[model samples]
Target chain A: MPRYGIPEYRLPYEMLDRDIDVITSLGVKIETNTRVGSDISMDQLHTDYDAVVLAIGLHLGRSTRIPGAEHKQVCKAVDLLRNITDGDKFKLPKQAVVIGGGNVAMDIARSLARLQKQKFGGVKVTVTALEDRAHFLADPVEIKECSEEGIEIFDARGPQECIIEKGKLKGLRTWKVRSIFDEQGRFAPAYDESDELIHEGDMIIEAIGQMSDVSILGEQLTEDLEWNRGRIQVDDNGHTSVEWFWAAGDCVKGPDVVHAVADGHRVAGSIERWLVGRQK
Target chain B: MTEGHSSDYERLQSKKSLAEILEVAVEFERTARDFYTNLIPKVSKQIRYLVEELAEEEQHHFDLFSKLKSRPDIEQLIQAMVDTPASDQRFSDAIHLPDLGEKPDDQAVLQFALGREHAAMEQYRSLAESTEEGPIKELFLFLANEETLHKNQLEKLYYETIHSGGV
Candidate 1:
């Protein structure tokens, strides 16, 4: 089994590991460290197998697009998580600011809290988001745990700019978010200018969203394949317009581990059926 | 309730033995007891206490069945137990003892117990329907009624939590 993306949630990791072990025990040769659309060449894949499955997950982090977002200290949430999980040592600042309200934001905030606890004898990770506490996207259990761990959370804040002083990190300026989405279901945050706060932080982590990088498909193949709102268009069985290529996982259905697993199963079944039919 | 004559009592009793019904009753009690025990740790302190009481009620059911099992003529009970449907097999299998090490929070536990009570009430109702005549049928009906009572109590607790934000 191919393990892509960060592994923090234990359920999918445990389930996938168990399944891979079981499948391997049954005499299936499962290759390891082969990242489709990246590490392994598509040419080699086409030459070796009749069909190629693209399960390359969405790892591209979304940007906040606020002023001073390009600062050296402002890092993507995924990168930070990957670095932490890989046991890489970094000098985390005394105060850190996390931007977003999703589960990913919660995970990074909690992880940073633990790290700060270990380093500074206390946690000083602050999470700010457009959504209120009740409307937060993080699971209630996660929110409760974060509160229990003493991580500071500020809700309904729309980031305006990262404050800098003499080319040094100072803090972040945010206006109170009156509302996040517009009437037409678009991202148009309305902010209350009167209600403004300057949150002091040495580092800022963006955990807004993620997308797939399809640039590796090359300009020629990109035009040849069907596209649906920037995502690769696939049939019900995960079959792409190109018969030889099948795509699944986060590349096709966004970043959900269970959805990826379900997509894999569907695409595998479809491939098996197609191959069997061709033999007949 | 009208007391029947000896001949009427014999006629009703002889239709199916008491031994069979007692067997099924024992199984149902075991399942209910296991479900309650499993649910205790998942609920709040008050809910846990309530579930413990439910488990005790299941023990009472077991004792009732045991008494019926010791009767001289239990042929009706035996027949009733034998004819019990396989639908309840799921209940028997799924009724796990509580895992004390990793207790779920209060809301989860209460919801679980509430669900189990609803399922048990349905199962007992079906069991009651499968029996015919005399004390065997009466016993099944009595157990079913008790399950309904437990279900009502659990429902009340569930609603109370929902409205009061206790869970």
Candidate 2:
């Protein structure tokens, strides 16, 4: 959805229904409305099948430790996009401040701009990011088109806090970002504290990035699984530490559809090879 | 990067200079129109008319963009309108351009053209969202509506050429 320019609308009803029809005709039973860690459990899945592969993607958005970040209007980009895609009719805010400089930021900014235009007759979205424009995380096309779409893009700006007065969001207090990387090229950001800018808005959205959800593994199983750098450690073939359990997709890699598809194929191949060897 | 380009882009985002936005918009419109003019020769006569029609509509949009850019006092209304919200119903998705090699078939050419018009329509609607009310926004709406018409027409042509044309 973010890579391809298509926004808001998915496939026309007939086409989507047809696609679902075809997928279902393949004799593969599919279930929607069920979620792991709650509606379903990994233990149940493993007991029902000989081998289990965990492909649970990262759905949680990273939050900042900034002051007043817990305001009701402060939200994640994914949550806002999901709400819009889910056809939620919301009263558009007078101003929306989006924190982050990635494609997800652009997605939220642009989508909200459309809604604001329909509701108020003009766009009022300001996107503030840590990296400067030259080093922005979002695709250059997304940046340019978003600018052309009238979304305010602020590069090299770091969010200090979500400003609130009288229990209401008033603006986002930010500092000018001096450097996004350390001398060793780490992800540490250096900001100019003296240089501050307060972007007034009714809402603040964090689009910095996303993290995977691994709670479905449960306490015992999760503790037993070897992990690396906050992600499940998997071999080149996507095999987890546990012989019978494997991991793939964003839970193993990150948030990317193409990567998820490639991971799916690799794990499938590994499963096939293992099954054949066992039979022999 | 310019010394204050970042700050400028931020300030510019909420309220853009009317002429600058229109100028860029004109370039995009012209590019989309010229896209068809260049692709017609690569396609057979079976689809040339459809391409020509698309090109003409895009050219009309280009003319509209130019006209909107030239208006006096547009700058004054620009700040106000730009501050106001504008509606856009057009949608966009990723699309690939028509490849010149492989002696591409009519179906491929039609599909590419269909995607192009779809993108153009979506672009105009998006531009409308950024543009303020009055003539400029109206111009964007006009061009966007025009692109929608072109997209629908192209969709029909594609349906006939593909579904009815026996693949």
Candidate 3:
């Protein structure tokens, strides 16, 4: 996450490399460009090593499935962030509309705003979310910085459709959300049909959420494993159903740096205990 | 994974009656309660309470569905016309109880329960996503969110039970 998912501004690359240097200093082997389930099979790993830890996090960005969302201009925040980190070429939109009200959304918005500023000497980015300002899922600091960056914020707006003119992307059509949850506390968002607005932009970014790409586990391993929601099921100690295999980090739990680090410790402890028991 | 991402959103839509949906949901809860109750004997003494709590939570969900089924407002929605073969396939298909095998450890049992809770949450989420915005959608969304919260709670309890100083 620190390497590619997070922006350089938030987490400097030098600091990330230094932390990696410390881990490598301790004789830990780090491999790059070696894709698991492709370069090496899980069965081979089980035979070669006593344990296998799968910490493949949520790398795929989710789509809202609204009409016109399949357009090239309608990008996922996760993908955009990764592209920016990889130094890949991306067209900076003159006006962009971002959906979602989380830290990632803010990151994308602010990042794009900076890019636009550099390219055009101005920023025209709009962020719309289902939650009102009182209940934004984003950190207060992120929200504040977005305004400081001169990005527009529209709270409680539920995306209905992506506006496309001819073959090009236009903007997003959204309605004001009356309530995000029902009396029973469900995620069913009710919108005020009368209160609607079309935010004009050439690009729309869906920063709603992300999910782990489990296809890398291969078909057999996926079927053999237990899953919760869409994540591989693991015990409190991060042990998977398969005795030799274990999963932790964002693959088992959602995104959170502290939680991921805690999980790393938890899984390490479990592996240590197992190794000790094996020795005895 | 993200909470609402489903590839089969369109295919998951049911033509079954609202009453049928409630029936299947209630049955799901009942089966979950039974599953956890069955696990109680397999788990260790220290974590037996966890199984009991899980079973109780399922019962509470069942009660909520039952109450909703009896509500006067729900009757109108239940009778609304929608065409398709009626079957409890979705809920029934998702109901797979984990095999604890012989001499189950605390971690094994907790892992099994976590799997069940996650499956329950996923099923409800799919239902919520497939259905149009309405009371029924709200109902399924509510169930899904409840399962999510329950899953989070169970994760916390599992850590406290399994870890020494809390990772």
| DockQ (Cα-based) for each candidate | 0.01, 0.01, 0.04
lDDT for residue B125 in candidate 3, whole number 0-100 = 80
TM-score of chain B of each: 0.61, 0.64, 0.75
lDDT of each residue in B57-158, candidate 1, tens digit only = 778867876776776665434544334444466555546544534545334555566566566666656666775666655766776677666656655544
lDDT tens per residue, model 2, B113-133: 666666666666777777556
DockQ of candidate 1? 0.01
Stronger candidate by TM-score (1 vs 3): 3
lDDT (10s digit) by residue, model 2, range A63-105: 6547888888898777777677667766567999998877778
Q: Against the unseen true structure, what C-alpha lDDT does each candidate score?
A: 0.69, 0.70, 0.78
Q: List pairs with backbone clashes in candidate 3.
A: none
Better of 1 and 2 by TM-score: 2
Deviation of model 3 at A261, angstroms = 1.6
The parts of candidate 2 lying over 4 Å away from their true place are: A1-22, B1-167
Candidate 1 on A1-280: residue-level lDDT in tens? 1233453443355766798899899898978766656787666777899998887676666666578988888887777877776678777878989888777788878888888988899989888887778667777887888889888889999888998888887888989988755454344356899999998999998877665556566544665677663467899999999888898987777667777889988998999999999999
Residue B166 in candidate 1, Cα distance off native in Å: 34
